[model samples]
Target chain A: MSTATPVTAGADTAAVRQAIATTARPPRPGPLSTALTFGWRGMLKVKHVPEQLLDVTVTPVMFLLMFTYLFGGAIAGSTSAYLDYTLPGLLVMSVLFTTVYSGVSLNTDLTKGVVDRFRSLPIWRPAPLLGSLLGDSVRYVIAGTVIIVVGVALGYRPDAGVTGALGALALVVVFSFGLSWVFSVLGLLLRSPNAVMNAGFMGIFPLTFLSNVFVDPATLPGPLEAFVNVNPISILATACRSLMDGTPDGEAITTSLVVAAALAAIFLPITTRLYRSR
Target chain B: MTTHAPLAIEVTGLEKSFGDTHAVAGVDLAVPEGSIYGVLGPNGAGKTTVIRMLATLIPPDAGTARVLGHDIRTEGDAVRSLVSLTGQLASVDEELTGRENLILLGRLLGLSRSASRTRADELLEAFGISEAAARLVKHYSGGMRRRLDIAASIVVTPRLMFLDEPTTGLDPRSRGQVWEIARALQAGGTTILLCTQYLEEADQLADGIAVIDRGKVIAEGTPGQLKASVGTGGLKVRLLDPGQRGDAAGILERAVGAVVLDADPAALSVSSADASRAADGVSALARAGLGIAEFSLGQPSLDEVFLALTGHLAEERDATLEEQSS
Candidate 1:
């Protein structure tokens, strides 16, 4: 082969100069852009795997129908009253269940080496973790809306106006977001996806079930009642009920918001630290 | 190779430990700009650990490394911006298509939508993966996935690239294809830092080779220089008849002024300082009424050089593990 002509050499030099100039400038895809990129990719994954949405979509509808007809009359003394009582816990439960998937999703990414690939990139530090958290909120919102809409269809009335109902929904979404951060950290620390799922469920199930979600805490036994009164999930469920029923000034509502904020503050840093260490 | 030009990558006193075992201990190296520097070592010799530290993925326990004039500890983000690392395993997302994987990496590297798409198309074509562009990576062949993994690292046209055993588990043809890509990148002035256990790979590609044993570099030079540094070259003479082998070996040992290793009676091998002395030895042996046999002389191979410096063959490194465990 003949030696390179000046034309080819000139073109090569021009390309190199362009590449150098581009690299010398500040890196593109700033932190916010990188975060959104991760979030968008996660949402795309969810879009492709519609079967993964079965829990969020189908479970809430089934739970609403079963609880209203099967346990409503016996537990709440009447079916109508039971519908009003069970709706708040059902909404919160939907958010809780959705957050468990966040941990499993993160664990799957870690096991499959996807997270390691992200670590090799020149992107923002918290993008992958935060993006997954944000993307999973869509699942919570979808499930929450399905449960509430089914409740409305089955003759459960929300005394709160449209604004209060929306506010109540907003609280569930924010709480779910906060819970995802906690689970995301757990996913990073744990070895297997199943371990993350089981551990998350173990930590969350008691707080969710032992609370005054199914009935009034005042009516419970002594020690159990005291525990229920102090439980954060009880506060959140009570606050959600109050907001939907047009009674938003309860102590439970204030406590729930504070607890949600506190959990978020604690878990966000933990998740970021775990992500950086990995 | 470039007459001691400014180093593209420099590391001094690099050290890392995992719990009780020291992974990397007191290592130093300098890779010249636009040169292919190969760190040759067996598994668990801290090759991956060093690459991870240089890629800014893991913090070193103690040591300072500079890449493209930026410190790895304090200026990690800067080093990350200028360098790209492809790990030992394929790192592409299996769920995404080949085009999508490349585009995602390009976008993350700050390319605009059109630019990312264009770059992705170009890379797919360059790697001969254009036909598989729209197909999901989960369905790609092993070689295709490896190509895409390497292509993802070059999305930003990094000035420095770290390849940690890029051809591991690849077929011979695929390994040759990757070698071509590495050479092309170096020709474009992109500095490459490669780590591999394949002695032939280091011999063929490395401008400067560093042989790392345990946790430290025991030898560093150009391939030929390192081979020469092993001191003695040898000639192997194979006898046509197994019966005459013993007589031939005895005659050769008496004729040559060097050491003779006779493991197989059918083969006579002797180590001498130079080929001229070996020729004299062969003439003396032929005059001694011994049957003439086939003979060939050459410099020591990289494997021989490794054995001379480390006192253990590459294959023998694993055998020692069983002894230690027992």
Candidate 2:
């Protein structure tokens, strides 16, 4: 009804003048605060478009159910045992899959012109990128939680109990955070959101499957085994699996942290540079 | 072109090119502080490019600019701190509610959480968007989104604001509202660099105008000075009967200077440089028994001003731009 009325009906010229002339600008926000603000924006997007959240939520749930029920007997000879085996790997899988959306969302923001607003702001340059990833971390957490919850409901339990489960979730979230910077670069380089999505998955989807997310590397042929042995996802899954078992695989965990740190170190600056130039 | 007022934006030989296209080919401009300066051009005339550079969103290929005494090249952060740009496209987040968009900007600009909410509400009320503040911006009409975009820019009230084609695709009433908002901002001592393709938009809102063509400033002055430099206005007439328009054109040409026929068969116009002669042309039509529907003597439209300056219509790309009533 307000829209149907004349545009002027809503705008009182005197009030507009008063507001513009009277409002005092506050001091500029700090980098962390600005980034947190963008995180808030990401959360707002989730609130408005629940479908984006649903995309992350349902896809991982679907993956968990299909893998445990369909491939359980063939892969591990028991649904419950396979669930125990794959849930940690699937946790890594689900969370990594959600990282691609970081690029997709960044691409969306770029194409929509909102990035112009963010760029023009006097705040820290990497705030939006960092903040949105902070928001995507929520999606990662949700996906991980859902996978574990569904795994528990299906008669699978982590050998290391709640601490193991929580530790695994924390490790996956950190890795996802680092991996998201890679997609953020893609988002900046690509022209469209769809293009970014396709390219991101094109690289990530295969890398995900070729690793030991759904299958153990030992079952594969020698050449494939070597590839899977070096795959970072397999390394990350190994860390998650060990952490979930309360065994604490130091080599795998250290490798995953170093890989996460290395990815962030390599890609974060590139994403920032491309974001400025683009 | 010298004025006592301090300049808010000063540019010298600013240039930027995108691959083969020279989007901004060495444009220079001086915008006096506290006044609304319009960069008038057609679409793809590099108006957006110029604004983007001035806002420090993009670096210029080969020129220098100073906004509020800080150089855009060397002191970009300082320049950015003093200005805001509402892009040609609505820059507010579509997925966020209008209130959220403003609040987000406020918080980013460093307001406390409660202060951000308060300021957002105040802006929502002032811009007449309070009713729709809770609705996501994606659901907003073009007019509402434009309003919110402007509102977002002023949340921190920069010393200068770059409004790039602020009312491009809006209806006339929405356009008027935007004009009102621009004027209010100017009145509040915020110098506005308004970029627009609409000739009349510059004429109506700009205190001084730079007429850019093919990425160059072909003409620059106050609206009156720009119009005066192009000579005087024309005499536009609408004949009651389409049949009498031909006869009326003949009489008007004899009485006035040059006569150009309008697209309407019942309409024709005379390019008269003086008020007395334009009146005489109207009288001549009366004497010829040509019934007149309506007539007016006024300053030259910016189209004529543009044509005089550039030897081409302002809206040269798409002919439909000429049909828009100023």
Candidate 3:
């Protein structure tokens, strides 16, 4: 007998199996409690497999460092001045790119049947999906914080104090939350993880780069400029800029919020319904 | 507990479809309380599909079921509360250490943090993986991972368990270990619904067995009854001399009072309704001076039973999938 044998042998197997019926039923926890349990489990994933944090943490650090020095002087005349402009867009890009993870992790769970046990449990059926979305949002917040702190360190200053910086971060985090549903849809629709990543690359690039995130819309050709001026990514960067520069643009902020809300209203149902039907 | 036990599982006309293919056409089952029921089938025979419906993982398109006397359709929560499932794919988190997996399961079941930790420790020790409790399950061997998975399911010691191919991919030794665990669970008064492609597994473990093919229950009975339905136990005889084959066949058939199913050049076999008729054949052969190389009586092979119940051999899978997919 091994060390584990005695503990198991001491229990009466029949009594234990029947004990579920004899004992008082444990009160069922709310969906939030169940969801957070899974959310906490998701957070631990970045701990055990630290590589999962690369997209959120290391990418922000690397992008802020690279884009600030290389494109800064060329675009804005001085590296320090360019840091002010590029930092906002770079923050948006880093957080936006981190949304790819929601899709990847969700696809991994559904395809590998990782949540199969959760599906059979007595807990709220939607908890895993809700938890997964929340867990990914937490990752986005971490990425956003990294971008802003690194941006500040690189001579980029926000005219808006802590309050404005917090507001800007909140808006971006909510936008990232909505954008995650799109990737979540892709995660469910596509079977291959590689396909999900490729789709993210193809879809996210044109939206983020074609926008005025990196350069002024006034510097672009007429057609490209028109697209950039109306791009949702551009609206997001503009809102964050106004908030950070202490000159808030009400229309930009409203439009960005509206777009994020629309994305969530449409895709959230589709993702949840597809998930439940499975 | 009531003096009169209810059927642990009862269903009627369960149906489900994926696209044009009917994954489970229409299934009905009644499993006795505290008895092991086996659903035996080949790949794509809808064993997993039926189990999923019963386990409440997927809703059936039509029909209904009551598990532990609770309707699966309307009272899925009640049904789920009582039944635990170890799915075809081991559903434990690969990223979590074994201890974390158990703790998470406990927390979901409403155990407090300290209680969950205590329960997790108990389960780990019970499953004999206490030493590896802190190790990530991805690093565990196939046997250790599955043991821990089963251990996790018993966190509250569910009264009814659905084991969907609990030993599908393990080696013989690991398979034996899993079998022991399943037996222990059953001995603890758990009603088990076991689905497997391994006929030997069902035969050894299940008190009653159902042979499913193309999403339908083609045959259902005790293993003995099913095996007997395939035309009785078989009697095989091999002679030392090939020339004596015909003579041996006649003497044995006359001695055993059965028709010879096959007569090869040097060997002969017959259906023995009374498997013990081999004893009669032995004396008759000795009396006839025919040197017997071998003589044995055995029940029909499960494959033969499957072949008898369904037209094709059990291993030959459904060709309809290709037709439906195309």
Mind giving the per-residue lDDT tens digits that candidate 3 earns over A1-278?
67765544222344334433333446777888999988888887877876777756786677677766888788889888888887778778888988988898888887656666887899988788778777777787788888888877776789987777788888898898788899989988887787898898799987988987789899999999999999999999999989988999999999999999999999999998877766
Q: What's the alpha carbon RMSD for model 2?
A: 4.2
Is 1 or 2 the stronger prediction by DockQ?
Answer: 2
State which candidate, 1 or 3, has the greater DockQ: 3
lDDT of 2 by residue, A187-252 (tens): 888878989889988998889889988998899999999999999999999999999998999999
TM-score of chain A in every predicted structure? 0.86, 0.95, 0.89
In model 2, the runs with Cα more than 4 Å from the true position are A1-8, B234-302, B315-326
| Least accurate 10 contiguous residues by lDDT in model 3 chain A | A7-16
lDDT tens per residue, model 2, B193-226: 9998776788899999998987799988898887
The weakest ten consecutive residues by lDDT in model 2 chain A span A1-10
lDDT of 3 by residue, B87-193 (tens): 77788888889999999998999888898898888777666688888898889888788877787788877879999889988888778777777777887778999
- The fraction of correct interface contacts reproduced by each prediction comes to 0.27, 0.84, 0.47
Backbone-clash count (model 3): 0
Q: Rate the local accuracy (lDDT) of all candidates.
A: 0.77, 0.86, 0.80
Best by DockQ: 2
**What lDDT does model 2 reach?**
0.86
Q: Distance (Å) between predicted and true CA of B82, model 3?
A: 1.6
